[model samples]
Target: MIFSRERPFLLVGAGKMGGAMLSGWMAQGIDAAAIVVQDPAPSPEMAALLSRHGIRHVTEVPQGLTAGVVLLAIKPQLMDVVLPGLKPAVGDETLVLSVAAGTPVARFEAAFGPVPIVRAMPNTPAMVGRGITALFPTTRVSAAQRDTVDRLLSAIGTVEWLDSEAQIDLVTAVSGSGPAYVFLLAECLAEAGRKAGLPADLAARLAEATVSGAGELMHRSSEPPATLRRNVTSPNGTTAAALTVLMAEDGLQPLMDAAVAAAARRARELAG
Candidate 1:
């Protein structure tokens, strides 16, 4: 069964990421009344949103209400505080889906006591419904439970499953922290254009447009990135000149390798 149709689900934290997921669910025609949002202090945006949609809003967990699914959207640091209180509300049948970065499946299982747990890493782009999420489900999770999590996550963006728990950290480093890397590329490109004598405003505009357009192209085209690069690179043209520098011995390969590695290391540290 698609989880979107499941009624009376509980969102344990209505922060930015949680709110975004709520918005996506509502956009996809999920009944707002089926959701119960709990936050100590809901943002003005979240409050107004829930009110407008007629969804139940609570400053704390409601008594005598059992949710079909419990979304643990709270920060990782607050898990101990939140999970203990949440145990009562989470029935044995309830599937727990967590979007908290660095929180492991074992931790959730320990707290919730052998419940079906799914740990997901979703990037900031999820706010715009263009994100990619990596999901890792505990061994106890049923195929139906996994599908339910996938359906809910897919409402916001694309979803992929990882076989190994260790891959979750790599996924966090890649797609989770990947947006910042792309933004940094835009920053570098704009600054390089300004240094090469373009006006600041024009340089920024060009850099933004170029990056956005290239991304759109990749999304629409069937060709691989290497093929796309070769398509625009003439035998002795400006594109080729730039490629020579970027693909050289001291260029992108080593830089990106180090950057991803650092992010993966940081993810491991966060897990601890």
Candidate 2:
């Protein structure tokens, strides 16, 4: 379902995630002429992409240009300030898809007067076209519109449709913020390696490469992550020795559980 140009796609923000999504869309064969990017100051990379593709770019919502899809990819904190300027561009048939975390569909309905809205949470991995997005559409969104949104979001990566909006917060806590968690793991691994007498640069490279390689392997394999983990562990092996500590009653599991809970709590708080 390549987005057609009945009404142009009015992108609200063209920062990293948005830019990456646009890049993916272009790669997936969406017509660049059917897109309008509204960003006051796109990053250099994004700017270059826009220029290269001849995609329309505006500092603010353009007057008289109708939008088929108003994809809001800005930060949640900026929603209020950005919402008012967007109303004029949205049409009755437009689908409002938001990738901003903690922003509920009600918030958009309040501003747009009962439009079809979707609240989604996509991680930074979208920048590499490997991200997964969780989408929850309002009742106003029809099945056809949902399919359109799915195709659009699929440009970034896989799309998961949620049964309830409440689950968005949990998804946000996990995959939405999961990249940072993985990065921290890499950082910690590097530091531990350095402490164990490896050179800093070599340790950092080893940790990063290992994490990315393992992730790639997992991506290509049909095996479950737990199965892969078990395959890596052997009787009295070095990996098993480390797993013993990590699997302890008060180890990574509890810490991760607490961390995810706190993130979900904060996401709920941010919704208000």
Candidate 3:
């Protein structure tokens, strides 16, 4: 068991990300009885899940209880208001795990003192058990606590530890917002195919399948992506022609660089 049953886990929100993590934890065999959810207005789907599992759901943080782990899954905007009330749940031994982006460790320290806090950003693919999450642990975090946090997070997907919190903004721009970029590519590819005379529906299906298949192939391959691209590109072939345009001086790389920079800047703004 990743968590100790002595003190219950207090989940501060039950939105999509929080609910996804909750579902992942339950599916991994964490005791449902050891979990308590605090969300004023959870979706019907999430409410149904809490009911089915018999996990405690509360609109407010209950008094007179010390949580073993307090997972902060609320929005960054709500941190200032909501955190002040969670003091009762955080004991000295508790590990605070946050999945809220743009909210740093200092903000948490302001709320609950110098307790062990880990701030993380997880991509949406975590719901399907294929996500990648980047975490930044404060100096206060113990080695054993880090291991526990790793185990809990690994329930949903890959967990990577960061050396500095500033890198979080860069990560937010890349993998944190990366899935949307891939989806956009698929959309553009389908439109291009339709414009080139393929049936609209067929083009959409082909684009979706190709994107997903390529992603899976990349996932399974040991070689770097460049090697895979080389293997796919035959001399003077259709793919090679397309790559020529995409790899040009003013091509995909520059566009992606600008997009990521913009996202990172926004992340920093949100943090402040």
lDDT per residue as tens, model 1, 179-202: 899999998999999999999999
Instruction: List where candidate 3 sits over 4 angstroms from the true fold.
Output: 1-5
Which of 2 and 3 is ahead in TM-score?
A: 2
lDDT of 2 by residue, 1-272 (tens): 42356578889899888888899988888888899999999999999999999998999887787788899989899988999999998777888889888888889988998788888898888878899999998898988889888887788888999999999999999999999999999999999999999999999999999999999999999999999999999989999999999999998999999999999999999999
RMSD of each: 1.8, 1.3, 1.3
My TM-score estimates for the predictions, one after another, are 0.94, 0.97, 0.96
Query: Cα deviation in Å at residue 18, candidate 1?
Result: 1.5
Clashes of each: 0, 0, 0
- The count of residue-pair clashes in candidate 1 stands at 0
Q: Residue by residue across 161-232, what tens digits does model 3's lDDT show?
A: 999999999999999999999999999999999999999999999999999999999999998999999999
Model 3 scores a TM of: 0.96
Question: In angstroms, what RMSD does candidate 1 have relative to the true structure?
Answer: 1.8
Q: Whole-model lDDT, candidate 3?
A: 0.90
Global local distance difference test of model 2:
0.90
